[model samples]
Target: MGVRSLPAEAYYGIQTLRALENFPISGLRPLAAYVDACVLIKKAAAMVNGDLGCIPADLSQAIVQAADEILNGALRDQFVVDVYQAGAGTSHHMNVNEVLANRALELLGDQKGNYQRLNPNDHVNYGQSTNDVIPTAIRIGGLLALERTLFPALADAIATLDRNAEGFQAVVRSGRTHLQDAVPVRLGDTFRAWAQILSEHLIRIETASGDLTLLGLGGSAAGTGLNTHPHYRQRVVARLAEFIDQPLRPAPHLMAAMQSMAPFVAVSGALRNLAQDCVKISHDLRLLDSGPKTGLKEIQLPPVQPGSSIMPGKYNPVMAEMTSMVCFQVMGYDSAIALAAQAGQLELNVMMPLIAYNLIHSIELLGNTLAALNHRCLQGIQADRERCLAYAEGSLALVTALNPHIGYLNAAAIAKESLETGKSLRQLVLERGLMSAEDLAQVLDLDTMSQLPGDT
Candidate 1:
C-alpha cells in the first residue's frame, strides 16, 4: 500500500489508515460493547504476557494502562474502521491493536507511530491472531450484552406483566380463536401467560448462551497453537474469566471453536425465538388497544406522541409497533448470522464481522426495545372493564356454556336462532326452555366461566 497520512492527533496507525481509506463502507463504527470486549482481551493478554515473561514488564504495563483508559471511556473514536471491513474482522482487529499500541507508546514517553519501542503486531497483538481473537470477542460481547442489557430488561418486563396480570385478574373478556369469538377469558391471565412465555424464552436464551464460555484464544493462526506459549491457553482464559467475572474455559478442540460459528448462531437463534414472542405480544397489545371508536378497545395504551400527521387527536400503540420493528430486525440479523455461520471454510470464518455485529446488535436492540415497551406501554396499560364485560356478555361463544346443560345440538340451534332473530343467546335459550333461569345464570356467569381452575 502507498503511504497515507493520518491526523497528528490520531492514535490509529498505518494499517488502520489503509483500512480507513480502503473500506469506506457503512458509516457505522464498532459497538461500545464490542470495543470493550476487544479491549478486555488486550488487557488480559498484556497482564498474562507480562507474568509469563513473553513481553517486557514495562511494555506490558503500558499496554494494560492504555486498555484501561479505553475501558474507562477514552479514545473511543480511534476505532474508526468501518464495520464492513476486511474479512475475519482483520481491519478492525488491527484498528484496536494500533490504537492500543500507539497509546502505549505515548504512555511510555514515546511519540505515536513509534513502533520500534512498542509495535502493534510484534507486541500489542503478540501471540494472537484475528481468527481466534475476533471469535472470542464475539463471545465476550454476547456475554456482556446478556448480563448488562437483555437479562435485566427481560426481568423488568416479566415483573411488569406479572403486576399487570394481578391488577387485571378480575376483568373477564372474550377469547378469540381464528379471529372469532371462542370463549370467555380473564384479561389478567393473558398477561400472566405472556409473562410465562418470556420466562421460558429467558431460559432458552441462557441455555443457548452457555456455549459462549468455551474459547479458542490460544489456538493462534489456525488452531495449531503455533508460536504461543505452552501455558498461554489456560492462563489467558483464566485471566479473561477473571477480567469479565465470568467462568470461561478453553475449548477442548480449539479448531472447532475458531472454525465453527455455532455459538453465535445458537445465541442469535435464541434471540430470534425471543423476538418472535415479542412480535406476538406487541401485536396483541396493538389489537387490544386498536381504536377508541372503531376497534376492539379492550385496553388503552398510553400515548407517547401523536401518531398521525394529518389526522388530529390520533394516538397509536407506538411502543408496541416499535417493538415489532426491532424484533423483526432481530429475526433478520439471525438469518444473516445463520448464513454467515455456514459460509465459513476449513480453518476460519471470514464472515465473523457480520456475525459479531448482527448478534451483539440484536441483543442490545431487543433489550432496549423491550425496556421501552415495558416502561412506556405495558406499565401504563389500562384495561377497559366495561368493554371487557360487554364483549364477554355479547359474544355468541357464550352459548358454549349451554353445551353440558342443554346439549351441543340444542346450544348450536339456540345460537343460530339468536343470530337470525337479532336476539341474545340467553333470550333464545329461555324461550326454548333449554335450561332453568337459575341454572343458566350460574352457567353463564362470566367470573365463574373465566376463572382458572383453582381460583376461589
Candidate 2:
C-alpha cells in the first residue's frame, strides 16, 4: 500500500482507496441522506471549532465551504467506500473526511491529497471519531428520512384512506375473520380501520424517533470527550441543531449512547410493526380484488400493469403486491438491525455500517412503497356495490342477527338448512315459522347491521 497514487482528479484520498481494496464487498455506496448527515456534522464541527479558535478561521472557512458545496449538490460521487466496509463505519467515515479534506484543499488554492496543507483526520475530523460521528450520522440520517420521506408519505396515505373510508361508508360488505364470513361491515369502515392503523404507526414512529435527538457527537473515540474543547460538545450540538433545524441535544450519558444502538433499533422496530399491518392491508386488497369472474371481486384495485406475460387482458394487484414485498423487506431489515444493535461489545458496536444502511434504507423504501401504493392502488379502488350487497345478503353468517329474534339453536338450524337446500336464510326462516317476514326483514337489514356504533 506504500507509494500508491490516486487519480489526479479524485477527491477521495489513500484511505478510501485502501478501503476500496480491503472491502470489495457490496458495491453499494453510502446513502445520500447518510452522506448529508456526515457532511452536516463536519460543517457544524468546523463552525464550532473556528468560533472557539481550535482551528484557524481561514482553514475552518475552507472546510465549511467544502461542506457547503457538498450540501449544495457537489462532489456527490466522492464517497466511494463500500457500504459493507470497516466495522463501525470507519471506512465510510474516513471516506467523508477524505472527500471533504481534499475538496477543502482545492478550495484553499492547493492540490488534492496535499495533507501537509490540511489533514483529513487532524482538521476535517478534529475532535470526532468514527464511534461518535457514525452514531450521530445514523441519528441525523434517521431524522432527516422521517421528516422528509416517511412522515409525509404516511400522512398522505392516511388522508387518502380516510377519504376512501368516508366514500365507502354506505357500501356494506361481508366481513371475514379467519377466512370465514363473520358479520356485515361497511366497506368504508374497512378503510377507516386501515387509516387508524397507519395513524397509530405514525405516532409510534415519532415516539421511537425521540431517542434519535439525543446524540453522542462529542464522545470522540470512546465517549471520554478526549481532545475536545471544553465547550465543544454543547457548541457542536447547538450548531448541528441549527444546521438541520432539529432539536438535537447531547446525550446525557455519552458513554451509554455511544456504546448502545438502542435508538436505531427502536425506530426500526416501529417500522417493522408498520410493515406487519401493511402486509395485512395489502393482502386484504388482493383478496377483495381477487377476480372479476369467479372470486369475490367486491372491490377493484386500479391496475398499474398487465398482470401476466401470457394471459391477455389480465390485470394484477401489482402495487399492493409491491407494497407487501417492500414491507417484508423492511421486516427483514428490522431483524438485522435488532441483531446488529445487540452485537456491540463493551465499548462499541462495529455493526453500525449495517445498521445505518438497513435502517435508513428501510425508512425510505417503505415511505416510497406506501406512497406509490396509495397513489396507484388505494386511491383508485372502486367498490362494486351490487357485489358487496350480494355478498352481504348471501353470507350464512348474516343469521348472527337472527340469534336475538329466534333462539341461537333455531337460528343455527335455519342457517344450516339454508346452506344445504340452496335457499336464502329469509326463505328458510319464514318457511320454518321462526319469525314473521316483517321482523326478519328488519333484523337482516344490511345497512342497519353494518352501521358503525353511534351512527344515526
Candidate 3:
C-alpha cells in the first residue's frame, strides 16, 4: 500500500512487508500448514485454468511448479505475515500470492519483482479473492491436520483405555458418586466409561465436520464471481476433490457460503466437546493417581519425571495434568472462535485470522497432548488391586446390597451402625442376625457386588 525498499532476496513483496510492519501481534506467523493449504489451492486452480484455455500453458505450468515446491515445504520461512494481521486473513492470503508469484517468476527465468511477466493479482490470483480462498484454505488445512494428527492421537488414547478396561476388570473398587463411596465397581467400568465419552466425541467431530465438505471457492470478491469464467467453480472443485482425496463440492449459493462462518463454528464446537471429555478423563486419572501413601492411591500412574524438587518420592500424574491444561486452552479457543463466527458482518468476518490460528493450533495442541498422555501415562498405568479391594471392603455403602432384602430403613440402620462401630457392613448385618450365613455369602460376593443392579 506504500512505497518501500524491497529486500534483495526476500520472495515476499510489498503487501507482505506492509503486513509485517503493521500487525506485530502474537509474534506468531500463520502456520506452515495453512500456507501449504493455500498453495495447494493455487496449484489446482492453475492446472484447471490451463486446461480450460484461460491461461497460457507455459505460465500455468510455472505457477503449478511453484505451488508444488511450496506444498512440499521448500520455502516455508518466506511466509512471514503475522497470523494476527488484518481480518479475513487478507495479509496472509496476499503473502501466499506474492510468494508463489515470485517463485513462479524465478522458474520462468525472470528476475524477482518482475510483476509485468507474472503479476500476483492478475495471473497468480486469477479467479480468487482473499474472502473465499482464506476460509477455504483454513478448512482444508484443518481437515489434513485432523486426519494426520488429531484423529490418530485420539484413536491411540481410546485404544489404550480400551485395553486397560479389560485388563483391570478384576480389580474391584469402591465406586464414588459426588466424591462419596456409594457401591462397588470394577476398575474396568471406569475406563469403559471414559472410552465411551471419547467415542461419542469422535462421532460429534464427524457430524460437525461434515458441513465443511461444501466450500466457497469460485466465490470471488463479495461472492459475485466477477471476472471469473462461469465453469471455473465446477472444474476447480472437481480437481480439488481428486487431489484432496475427499469428496468435496461447491456450495449451491456462493454468496451465502462466502458470508457464513457457521461450518467453522460447528467444527469448533466439536473440538470443545472433545476438550471437555479430555478434561473429565484427565481429572479422574489425576484423582485416582493422587498419592501413593496418603491419597486415593487406587491406581498407579507411570512416573515420567520428578514432580517436586523439595520432596522425596514425589511423583505426580504430570501427563494427565498437562492434558487437563491443554483441554482448558482448547475450550478457550472454542469460545474465541464462537465469538469470531458471530462477528461476521455482511460479506466477511474480520476475525478470521484469529479463527484460522486458533483452530489449527488447538487441533495440534490437543493431538500432541493426547499422544503424550497415552504413551506416558495411560499405557503404563497399573491398577492397585490390593488397595482397590481394601477400599471396597471398608466402604460403609456396601449395605446397598442388603437394601433389596432388608428394606431401606433396616439397610440404613445397618449402614449407620457399621460406620459408628468401626465394623464392616457385613459384620453389622451378621451381628444383628439379619440374614442366614449362606444368604449373606451370596449377597456380599465380591464379583456380585461389582455387578450392576440389573445383573444382580
Candidate 4:
C-alpha cells in the first residue's frame, strides 16, 4: 500500500501485481483446475473460520460469495501469475486471496483494493498459510481431474479394447521373437493383454490418488498449525470434504504433509507408468499398421490424416504417434515432478509450483489423449485376416508343431529342404511321406497352434 498509487479497479492487489512483474518466465497463466481449486479452498476456509467465530459472519459471507463467483469461472482471468513463479505456490495463493478480497469488498459496497475494509490475508485467507493452502489446492485440483476426466476416459478405452478383443479372436497372426517369426498367436491376445494392462494401471492410478484425500489445510506457515485453533484443521477438512463430496481427511502429521512432496511424486509416478504403457501399446499398433505393401500390414489403423507431403494415398499412424508423443511428455513431466519433489529443504517443499502444474497437466493430457486414441484410432482398427493367416501359415516356426513328431534334426533338414526347393512346410512333409495328409492336417492347424484354438 505504501509503494505506489493503486489501480482503482485492480482486483488483484500489490502481491499479485508484484508476482506478475517478477515472473514473466512462462507466457502461460495458472489453469482453470488450479484457479478453481484455489477459489474452492478459500471458500471452505472462510466457512470454517466463520464457524469457529474467527471471522465476522458478514465478512465470511462476502468472501464465500465472491469466491463462489470465481469458482463458477468469474474473474478467473484476474489470476494472472505465471505457473513457474515463486516456490510453494505462495504467489498463486496470494493472487487468489487478493482477487477474492477485492471482489468481496466490491460486493460489500466498498471500492476494490481497499484493504482496510477487506484485507486479503486477514479476511479471505484467514486461517491459512501458503504451505497448507497451496498443497491443499493442488490435491483438490488433481482429485477433481482424475474423478471427472481421467477415470471416465480410461473406462471408455477399456470397454473399446475388450470389445475389439472379442471381435478379433479368430484372426491368427505370426508372433515374432527378435523380429523373426517365432510362433502363431491370435490377434485378439494383443488387445486382451492391453486391456488387462490398462485396467491394472487405472487401478494403480486410483490407488495413488487416494493419498490426496489427506490434506494440509490448517498446517499454517510451517507444519505446526501455528496461529490456528486446535479444531481448525479437522473442521476445515470436514468442510472441504462436504463441499467437494470427496472422502478427505486432515493430514495426520502436518509436517509430513507440508514437507514431503511424496504424494505428488507417487501420483506422477503412477501416471508415468500408465504413459509408458500407452507408448508401448501405441508402438505396437504402429508396427501392426506399418505397411500396406512393403511392411507387416497385419492390421490396418484408421487413416485419419494424410501421412506425407509428397507421397499420394499415404496415411500414417498419426494418432498412435500422437499417443506416443503425449506419453513421452507425461514422462518428462514425471521427471520434473521427481526433481521438484526432492527439492524440499526442511519444513516445507519449495517446489510446489512445479509439482502442481506438471501433475495437473499430465492428468488432463493423458486422459484426453487416450480417449481420442480409443475413439479415432483403436475402435476403427481392422485386421487383415488373409495377410495374418498367410504370415502364420508361411512362417518357419510352423516347424515347431512338427518338432514333436519328427526329431529336431529331421525337422531342421525338412526346413532347409523347403527353403531350398521353395516348398511349403505341408508340401515338403507330405512329399517326403513323413505323415499322412489327415494326420498332418490335424497336427498343423495354425489356429490351434496360435492358442489351443477353442472354436476355430
Prediction-by-prediction clash tally: 0, 0, 0, 0
The TM-score that candidate 4 achieves is 0.96
CA lDDT scores, all candidates in order:
0.93, 0.93, 0.87, 0.89
Q: State each model's C-alpha RMSD to the native.
A: 1.0, 1.0, 1.4, 1.8
Clashing pairs in 4: none
- Model 3 residue 335 lDDT score: 93
Please list the residue runs of candidate 4 whose C-alpha ends up more than 4 Å from where it truly belongs after superposition.
Answer: 5-9, 452-456
Cα lDDT tens digits, model 2, 1-456, are 487778877888888889998999888989999999999999999999999998888889999999999999999988888889889998899888999999998889998888988999989999999999999999999999988889999999999999999899999999998999879999999999999999999999999999999999999999999999999999999999998898899999999999999999999999999999999999999999999898889999997889889999999999988999999999999999999998999989999999999999999998998889988988899999999998888999999999988889998988888889999999988888979989988999989999978998
Question: Tens digit of lDDT per residue, candidate 1, span 355-385?
Answer: 9999999999988988888999899999999
**Which residue pairs in candidate 2 collide?**
none
Winner on TM-score (3 vs 4): 3
- lDDT at 7, model 3: 82
Write the candidate numbers in order of decreasing lDDT.
Answer: 1, 2, 4, 3
Q: What is the per-residue lDDT of model 4 for residues 1-456, given as tens digits with 9 covering 90 to 100?
A: 458554765788889888888899978888688787888889988988888899889889999999888887788778889999998898988999999998998899988878887889898878789998988988999998887778999999999999999999899999988889888988988898899999999999999999999998898998888888788889888888988899999989988898888889999999999999999999999998988899999999999989899999999999999999999999999999999888889898889999889999999999899889988998999999999999998888888889888778878898888888889889989988989999999889876788844545
Count of backbone collisions within predicted model 1: 0
| TM-scores for every candidate against the unseen true structure | 0.99, 0.99, 0.98, 0.96
